[model samples]
Target: MTISNESDPFYKRLSLNLISIGLIAAALYIAQDILLPLFFSMLLAALLLPAVKFLQRKKIPKIVSIILSLTISLVLVFGILYFLTTQVLNFLDDSDMIEDKFNGLIRDAQRWVSQNFHVGIRKQNQYIHDTAEKIKTSGPALVGQTFLSLTEIFSYLIFIPIYTFLLLYYKDLIKKFLVDSFRNSSEHQVVTILQECQNVSQHYILGLLIEMTIVFSLNAAGFLILGIPYAIFLALVGALLNLIPYVGMLVANIFCMIITLISSPDISNVLWVGVVLMAVQFIDNNFLMPLIVGSKVRINALATIVGVLIGGALCGVPGMFLAIPGVAVLKVIFDRVDGLKAWGTLMGDPGADKQREKLKDAIH
Candidate 1:
């Protein structure tokens, strides 16, 4: 005889959790466009909230405080971008003097094309014409798509500030909505999760800032010592890429190689870039990141890799930035929810994981 659903607590709990997971996945896929901006706004708000709160305590009106904080944030962002863009002009000037890269690549391909396909230069030219004509046919749509992507980026830049300001200005209202949304959840648990979320956001963002500053300074100084041109620009690029976790440094290295190949006087400068990047990564992974940011987040290696991958899968670059803190927030909720304590522990510091196992043994 089949077990009655009412009598099968284990199966019932598992089924409910599976359904909840499916619903959450569907909602995330369905609402990603709106949710990505809101999530970004929440993160920026977290970073700026302390400044807003300080100004508020100084008798500044909420609107004034928000404007000031956002203004400062915008200035810092634009200042960094401005500095980089100015250096880019130098690259453009250098590019004008440099020979075209494809000329050499095309020259190298001539022997293979001739030998493998018995093709002459004139035939190759005709094929190239056909390809160019194909590209011409598609070029207008490609240009339109490029503009649409830029427009989307510009819209995101505009909305993120507005959303962050509103979030900071009406944080209490948001808090109440979050706490009240869970009718079956205990008030104490709800409050605890909210507080933990706040703490996670504050610690993660602040620690990341500190880590980026340290990395940027050291990388700049190292490049300076090596007599690297555009030292600050390269350092800033590297530091920003480092924010992505795991794969970021490799991408930064490739970027550095390209810039150095173009800008440096000697080809040996490319080798120096690699050595310096490795040294910087060693210092960061061993000393700085662990002490500053990693300790604050406490996500284990497996969970972190999975979180970053999942976040990247979900929302690309923004998701990578969000992965750690998002996992932290979920961990807070999971720790509070009775049946999900094990999953939370897996997401959390593994040092305490054994303690959870022993506690379960004792209770059973």
Candidate 2:
């Protein structure tokens, strides 16, 4: 006869852990609208905390310091947004030219396809006409969905600032709550987790900003050297979009290529755009990321990818941006908590011998 696994301590613990994880995932998904803004605001407050404290050091009132910190952050954020918006509006102002260029590109594509693949122009036209008809049929639904998405975005914008301010204002209360929630035996662990989480947020967000600025400068320089129109706009767009992880740069590359093709009237410039962006990506992945963003978060590649995919599935792009930091924070918690050291290992890099040994000792 066999022994029952359910009677084992490991099995009992595993079951409880799985149930807790399932409940947490469901809660996050269901409460995303309320939680997402709060989470984002938490990150913002963490990033700006030093500035707030510095102002207080200068003998400024705490309330005024908080307002000043928030004001500077908001101005920098909205200034970039305003610039991007103006660029888009300027692009839209030349709609007739864009349409003409698009049609010309389509014609060029059809000709190239005919020559290379022996597809008839008439057949291609028929395929395009059918696709257009399908799009026309679904256009109204698409429009409604877009409108709803925009409304949701604006609502988040309103809530995020309010939440951020409140979070900063009540940070001490929250810290006290965390300390009181744990027993004396675990109070130090709770405090360690809080400090680690704050450090992770600060480093991760600050590193990303530095990375983005460098990337934007490089991209702008490359585009300017190639004499690409709207060079700065495309560079900024590409740099900002690259924040979304693996999928982002690919989309940015395609977008920049399409814009280059449309505006430059040089097919070769499209290829150069791809080449330049790829070179930047290589530098970013191999050099910049390792030195900057990946220094604090030692997540394994597989875990990062899986986390990003799961985050995107659960909460879309914002979730994708949050995934790495979320995982980093979770890893920190897991390493400190009993019975979860293995999970910390699973999320962390494999070749970190010192870290692995430390984890092993903690587990023991």
Candidate 3:
């Protein structure tokens, strides 16, 4: 039943692949409301699978292992929430001081701008005054909305661990079903791809955790040294945001600048804070991440960006966070398929291609 080369079946197969991709995209779009939580659950399960397996190997009962793993996860979540709560309360307690410092900084900046550019300081002051009044009027509503958001977040938090444990407990059944449903020839390929996916996801998630820890620790130390108010809160926010990829660092830097301007009211402190952020970013981009993440997936920057955008558009922040590893898994599966190898190449790291070329030249 093999199609001979003269039949030119490649084009037909390619068309089929395109059709399948379109169908999958449409299905996902239609089902995203339910799919998002399932996707998050799967991701959490994937990240914790290695730990679960280790516990199993240690002769832990499956139920006990799931319980223990989820308990640790819950404790970590609560600890972070408690820390954030404490830091936020401290910030609120010093609200009046923060507001006075912010106002003084704004006045100084307005005066400097007037002196240098001959602009009307009074109009600028009026603008600031109007903005403050608007904020004052809307602040309570905004606070109410924020509380609602927090309630929703906690609701999601409660489900994630429960879902993660169920996934872990049923992982074997899921794998067995997948393998048994596939054709004999395809089963090995499917299993290999799944294992590779697990490895890729584990590396990405663990690498991200390491990266966040280092970034948060360094930023917190710098902020504390610089006497920045709410350093713990800001550092934690920055670390969590860093999981979003690409623009996360920029957001953290902007936040730090705003806090520095409002808290210190000193141009030197603001500039120093910016410098610290840049230094941390420089180290992260150049040294720490490369050493830690280290060629696990070999996905290119362009593909990564495109994947993140697609994921974000599909499922918000969780989608963005999951996108790269998801794409990597897709690429790995595509590479193993004879008809889809071209797509795998298209998604792969250009550096890998260069290395292949270099090896070919050496062989020649």
Clashes of each: 0, 0, 0
lDDT of 1 by residue, 108-208 (tens): 58767998889987789888999999999999999998997787688788888888888988899988887788757587778888887888888888888
Candidate 2 total steric clashes: 0
What TM-score fits each model?
0.83, 0.91, 0.81
- Which regions of candidate 2 fall more than 4 Å away from where they truly are? 1-7, 112-120, 351-364
Candidate 2, run of 10 with poorest lDDT: 351-360
Error of 3 at 266 (Å): 2.3
Alpha-carbon shift of residue 53 in model 3 (angstroms) = 2.8
Superposition-based RMSD of candidate 3 using all C-alpha atoms, in angstroms: 5.7
Error of 2 at 352 (Å): 6.9
Query: Which is superior by TM-score, 1 or 2?
Result: 2
| Ranking of all candidate structures by their TM-score, best first | 2, 1, 3
Candidate with best lDDT: 2
Q: Pick the candidate with the highest TM-score.
A: 2
lDDT of 3 by residue, 1-364 (tens): 7778867677688789999988877776777655666766777788877777789899999888788877886688689779888988887898899889877877788889999988899888788889999999999999998997687576567667777878888898989998998856699988998888778777877787788899999889998898876778878877787777677778888987887678765668878777877888887865565555645767777888898888888766767887877888899888888889998989887775465455457658
lDDT of each: 0.82, 0.88, 0.79
